[model samples]
Target: MSTGPLNPETSTSLPSPPFVHLKGIPNFRDLGGYKVAGSDLIVRRGYAFRCGEPTSATPEAIETIRGLGINHIFDLRSLPEIQKMQVAGTGPKTVDWPGVTRVFTPVFREESYDPVSLAKRHADYQSEGSEGMVNAYRTILTEGANSYSIILRHILEDARRSKNTAETALIFHCTAGKDRTGVLGALLLSLCGVPDEVVAEEYNLTEAGLGEWTELLVQAVLKQGAASEEGARRMVGARKDSMINTLAMLRDEFGGPENYIVTKCGLTEAEVAEIRHFLVVGE
Candidate 1:
């Protein structure tokens, strides 16, 4: 995969189709077309996406999202974040995209860290360096297993009954789509037999997608009293090592993503098999 912004011209060569670009929506991509290791199977294209919050999605972008045939949207944002960003007069607790089912499965409680406070806290911790980021990722894995499990079950059940059509597409997102979304994307791909290196590479792509916004985010943090400019900059950027370390911890402590899902998330072996069956297509 090219380590740069997804170029539609050369998208044919990509592991997945070119990422869908929506004005004001960052870090959005089709999570398909990856070849499974040691097998002839590949993840089916157009069935799933990973993205950042679409609170600022333009009218055209909303149409584009609808056109993608996404019937299910798994929002991972805390309630406070949703309350703060949801468009007024649309609906309470959901984006007013007609014909789409939006599920609010927050990985973290609103009281733990709402979107407004998380940015400031992220800046503070990130200023200290990677340790803060590493700790955050660890917490997502250990403390957020129930939410992850719920997400997995939704995907599994959806895929199991899907007609293998684009209309069955599912997407999940957080505020920035770099941390929480990255972790879930990593977990899903890792569970499907993608190598850890490839998983980390995918996680790092968020930097390319969100590079401009990252600067703006860092500046916002600085204005809000980050300890240092350099620290805020470090916090705003994505690092392969952070995700690499998280995966390593998963391996060392839980055996692998499957085990973690089974033990931590309480998914059964049969359900895991069902998910693999629906997602991995042999060509």
Candidate 2:
């Protein structure tokens, strides 16, 4: 149980210093080096990474991922999407990423991911704006804990066996790395004592990190769905107010992130503490 924050003066910004340019992987970034408000601690880098789908990852992209020493990947897409990715492979039709394990713990496991239904849902929210985001995130927080519990259990197990979390650093992502992945990132960063503002900022980076993929998605939604241009963009945009509202919901209704994990996610307090230690190491 480390109550102390990570000291950045003497520590590298990231566990794997010198960010490399990654091709074919959109919205990929290490979750580290962030200054938690009113503390000397920064979020430890390299232990966690958030990215978009990896099926389109190039061989060079795979090398960059391998270089991170990311031993595990948590995919938040449903069974249908996971099956599609397995057939899609890691870029080339048949290439597989050796050594690293890919785990599927779908955020919407039982719910069918039908394109017509998904489009209709987005169309239904065309005028809702941040309200839609707020409702969507609330559902994610309420029902998605079971999916997250799987990752947390693995993280605790790994932390118990080793002090160095970097050797076994892991990634978690959904298709666009925005909604489901953003909530997961926010929870992890909050547990590390990052401020709500900082958490929102980190979440908002999803669009920029998505780069070309962002526009492509917006176009696809506009063409295939009945959503307005704003609504189409909203589907991919990580507006700060949405996350702010979600964090407030997390605190007010869920009794804060820690309690949420302990009660809803089925993690013990001791396991949660160990995960915090593994994620935030002092210099």
Q: Pick by TM-score: which candidate is best? A: 2
Per residue, candidate 1 scores C-alpha lDDT tens digits across 1-283 of 1111221111222333437777656668887778789988887777788876665566777788788888778887777666554212122345567777888778876732422345566643554445667767777788778888888998887766773643477788876677778888888888888878878888887766664566556665566566777766666667877788888888888788889999999999889877877777866
Off by over 4 Å in 1: 1-16, 84-94, 112-129, 163-167
Report the number of clashing residue pairs per model: 0, 1
Residue 112 alpha-carbon offset, candidate 2, angstroms: 5.8
lDDT of 1: 0.70
Model 1, residue 145: distance off in Å is 1.8
TM-score, cand. 1: 0.83
* Per-residue lDDT of candidate 2, residues 1-283 (tens digit): 1111111011122223312346655567888877766767777777788876666666767887888888788888876555444212322121257878888788898552322124456444445446667667777887789999998888888788777645577888776678788899999889888899989988887756766665566665566574577777766678887788889888988898899999999988998998888777655
